[model samples]
Target chain A: MIAEVLTIGDELLTGNTIDSNSAYIAQRLTERGYWVRRITTVGDDVGEIMSVIREILNRKPSVLVISGGLGPTHDDVTMLAVAKALGRDLVLCEDCLERIKQFYEELHRNGLIDDPTLNEARKKMAYLPEGATPLENTEGAAPGAYIEYEGVKIFVLPGMPREMKAMLEREVLPRIGERKFIQKKFLAEITDESKLAPILNEAIERFRVKIHSSPKGFGKFIGIIIFAEDEAKVKEVVEFMEGKGIRFMEGW
Target chain B: MIAEVLTIGDELLTGNTIDSNSAYIAQRLTERGYWVRRITTVGDDVGEIMSVIREILNRKPSVLVISGGLGPTHDDVTMLAVAKALGRDLVLCEDCLERIKQFYEELHRNGLIDDPTLNEARKKMAYLPEGATPLENTEGAAPGAYIEYEGVKIFVLPGMPREMKAMLEREVLPRIGERKFIQKKFLAEITDESKLAPILNEAIERFRVKIHSSPKGFGKFIGIIIFAEDEAKVKEVVEFMEGKGIRFMEGW
Candidate 1:
C-alpha cells in the first residue's frame, strides 16, 4: 500500500519546530509495509491546508496520515480544513467530550487544573467532521479523527509527538494489519560511485529492484540499499553484484 | 516576501533521513523577513518532483528553495525534473563542468581519488536546466543551480548538509538582501491555555500581531510568540498583556 503524510503548523513552516512527527509516522508506516510516497508540510493557513488535502485526495493513496493543528488555539484549523475539503459539517463527538471532561476532572483533582468544566476552547477539541469517528487521545485533550473518503483511509492525529505517538500506537496501527517488506543493504569499499553506477543500474533493471548507492565521502565506502517486495529478486541482484567481484561488508 | 522549501530524496520519504535542510532554509528565510508558507518533501521520482514543482510554481511564492538530489547517482533526478518542468533542455554548463573537473583533480592530488578524470556519473552533475546559473560548491563535487521562473526566484542546492550549508551561506544569502522583523516572545506560568485563548485572540485582533501560545507540558508554563513587521505594534501588545496581570518572563 502507498501512504502520504501531511503536517500542518505555522511553527513548522517558520522553522520554529522540526517535524519529527512525520518522520516517526513514516517509519511506522514503512515498517507496516506501506510505501510512503510523499510527505508535505503546510502552514496553519486554512486555504493552503484545504488545497493540499484536495490534491492529496486526488492522488487517492491507500492511506493519508495528517498531523498537527489539533490544538485548542486560534491556529488549530486542521479539523476545520479537513471538513471543508471533505464537504462535511463540524459536529461534536459526545464520547470525545466526555473523555475531555473526565481528563480535566482528573487534572483538577491532581491540582493540574483549576476548573473541570469544559470551556469553549476545550469543547472545540470535541468537534470532528460529520460521520468521522473520534480516536482516543491517551496523552492529550484533543482527540484524533478518522474517516474513510472515497475508499481512502484518512487518519488525523495531533501534532504533539507524545500525544500523536500514543494515539498512533493504540488506535491506528492495529487497523493497518500486518505485512512484511523485503529490504537488504550492502556496503562495499568502493572509492568511486561513478564506476559502479552502470553496474548498479543494470542490476536494478535486471532484478526489478530499486537500488540506491550513497558514497560515504572520499576514499571510504559506498552504501547500497536493495528494496523490493520480491525477496528473490533482491537476492538475485545481490548475488550478481557479489559475482562481479564486489566485496560485500558485514553490514551497512 | 513569501518563501517555500522543497526537499527531494527517496531516503527522506522512506524514513531513512530526517529533513533538516528545509528547516535550515526556512529559518534563514524567516530571519530575512520572508514568511515561509510551506515546505514540501518528495522522493526521488521524476514525475512526483515535476508535479510538485508545477504546483509550487502555481502558488508563485516570491522565493522557492530546493535542496537535495544534486548528487552523482541514479536517484539524483532533481535537476532533470526541474529542467523538464520548465520545458528546458538539460544542457552541460561549462563553468560547472570545469568546477567538477577541478574538484576531482584536487581529490586525486590529495590521494582521495584514484582517477581524476570525470566519469559519466560525475559529469551528470555538470548538466543543469538551460539558462540556469551555477552556484559554486565549496565542500562537494556537485554545484548548485539558480534560476528565475515567472518572476519567482528558485534556488537548487546540494542535498548533503555540509555542502548545502556552505553554498547557502556563501552564494544564496547575499542575494536575498536584509530585512528586519519584529518578533518578541513572552513566557507565562499558566496551566490552562483555554482560559487564555480568548485574551490571545483579542490581542491578535487588537494589535494585528501573530501571537502563538505553546503550552509547555501540563501545569508548567506557556510560551507566547508575538510576531509582526511593526515593532510598535508588538510592543503595544506586550504592554497590554503585561497590564492585564500576565507576568512576563525575562526571555523566551
Candidate 2:
C-alpha cells in the first residue's frame, strides 16, 4: 500500500517555519510498511490546496495524510478545502465543543486563566467535515480529523510537530497495520563517479536496478541504496556485483 | 509564484526514514516568497511517481523540487520518471563525473576508504537526464540534479537532510530571487469563537477576505491569518476584523 502526505502552512513556503510535521509523518508512515511515495507541502491557499488534494486522489493512493490549516485563523482554510475535496459539509462537531468546554473548566478551576477562553477555542474545534471522525488530541487543544471515503483514508492533523506526532502515533499508525518490506544498499569508496558510469549502466541493465550516490567528505565515501520487493533477487543482484569485486558495506 | 515539493522513498512511507529534506526545501521556498503550495510524499514506485508528478504539474506550480530516489538502488527510479515527464533522454553529466573522481581522491587521501568502494559510489552518481544541470553535493556523494524545462524549474536533490540543505542553500535559493509576500495573523481573546463565527463569515463574505481558526488552547487562545499580494490590504483585512472585535495576535 502507498500513502501521500500533505503539509499545509504559509510559513512553510516562506522558509520562516521549517516543516517538521512532514518528516515526523513520513517516518511514522514508512515504519508502518506503507510505501510513502511522495510528500507535498502547500501554503494556506484554497485553490492550491484543492488542486493538490484532487491530484493526489486521482493517483488513488491507499491513504492521504494532511497537516496544517485546521486552525481557526484567517489563513487557516485547510478544513474548507478538505471538505470541498471530500464532498462533505463543514459542520460543527458538538463532541469537540463539549471536550473544549470541559478542558477549559478544568483549567479555570486550576486558575490557569480567569477568562479561561474555553468557548472561543471550542468554537474553533467544533467545525469539522460532516461524517468525519475527530481524532482526540490529549496533548493539544485542536483535535485532528479522520475521514474514510471510498476505501481511502484521509487523516488531517495540526501542523505543530508535537500535536501531529501525538495524533500520528495514537491514531494514524494503529489504522495502518504492519506489512513486509525489503531493503538493499550499494557502497563504494572510489573518487570519480564518471569512471563508474559504465558500471552503473551495467548494473541497471543486468539487474534491472537503480542506485543512489551519497558522497561524503569530498568524496571519501559513497553509499547507494538498492531497494526491491524481492529480497532473494536483490541478493542475487548483489552477488553479481561481488563478482565484479564490489563489496557490500551495509544494507542489503 | 508557487512551488511543489516531492519526496520519494519507501522508507518515508513505511515509517523508517524521516523526510527532513521536505521541510528544509519548504522553508527555503517559503522564505523566497514562493508559495510552497503542495508537498506530496510517495514511495519508489515508477508508476506512482509519474502519476504524482503529473498531478503536481496539473496544479501548475511554477517550480517542482524533488528529493530522494537518486541512487544506484533497484527502487531509485525518480530520474526515470522525471526524464519521462520531460520527454528527455537520460545521459551522463561529464563535469559531475570529474567532480566525483576528485571527491573520491580526497576521500582516499584522508584515509577514509580504499579505491574499489569509491569506484562504485562514483558510478552511482553518474547517471543524469540529457540537458540536466548537475548540482554538486559537497556534503554527500550524490550530485544533485537541476533541470529547467519550459517555465518550470525541477530539482532533484539527495534525500539526506544534510545534502539537500547544502544544495538548496548553495544552488537553488539563488535561482529564485526577490519575490513579494506578506504574512498576517489575527488573535481574538475574551470572546467565544462561535459568537464570532458568524461575524467572521460575514466579514469574509462582505470583504472577499479569508480567515482561519487557530485555536491554541482548544478554545482558550485563537489566531487568524490573512495572506495576500498586498501587504497594506492584508493589514486592512486584519483591521476590518479588529473593527468587528477580533483582536490581534502575533505574526500579523
Docking class of 2: acceptable
Model 1 lDDT per residue over B135-207, tens place? 9999999999999999889999999999999999998888787665556777876655556778788888987
Highest-scoring model, TM-score: 1
Model 1 interface root-mean-square deviation: 2.4
lDDT of 2 by residue, A1-252 (tens): 778888888666655566667767765665455656667777787887888788788778898899987665556788888889878888888888887677667778878756655444346666888898999877666678899878789998988777788888898888777653355655665545444556666776877554444443444445666644468867776777667656566742
Please report how far candidate 2 places residue B180 from its true position, in Å. 7.7
The DockQ assigned to candidate 2 is 0.33
| Clash count of each predicted structure | 0, 78
Off-target runs (Cα >4 Å) in candidate 2 are A29-31, A116-121, A169-252, B71-76, B116-121, B178-252
Residue B252 miss distance in model 1 (angstroms):
4.5
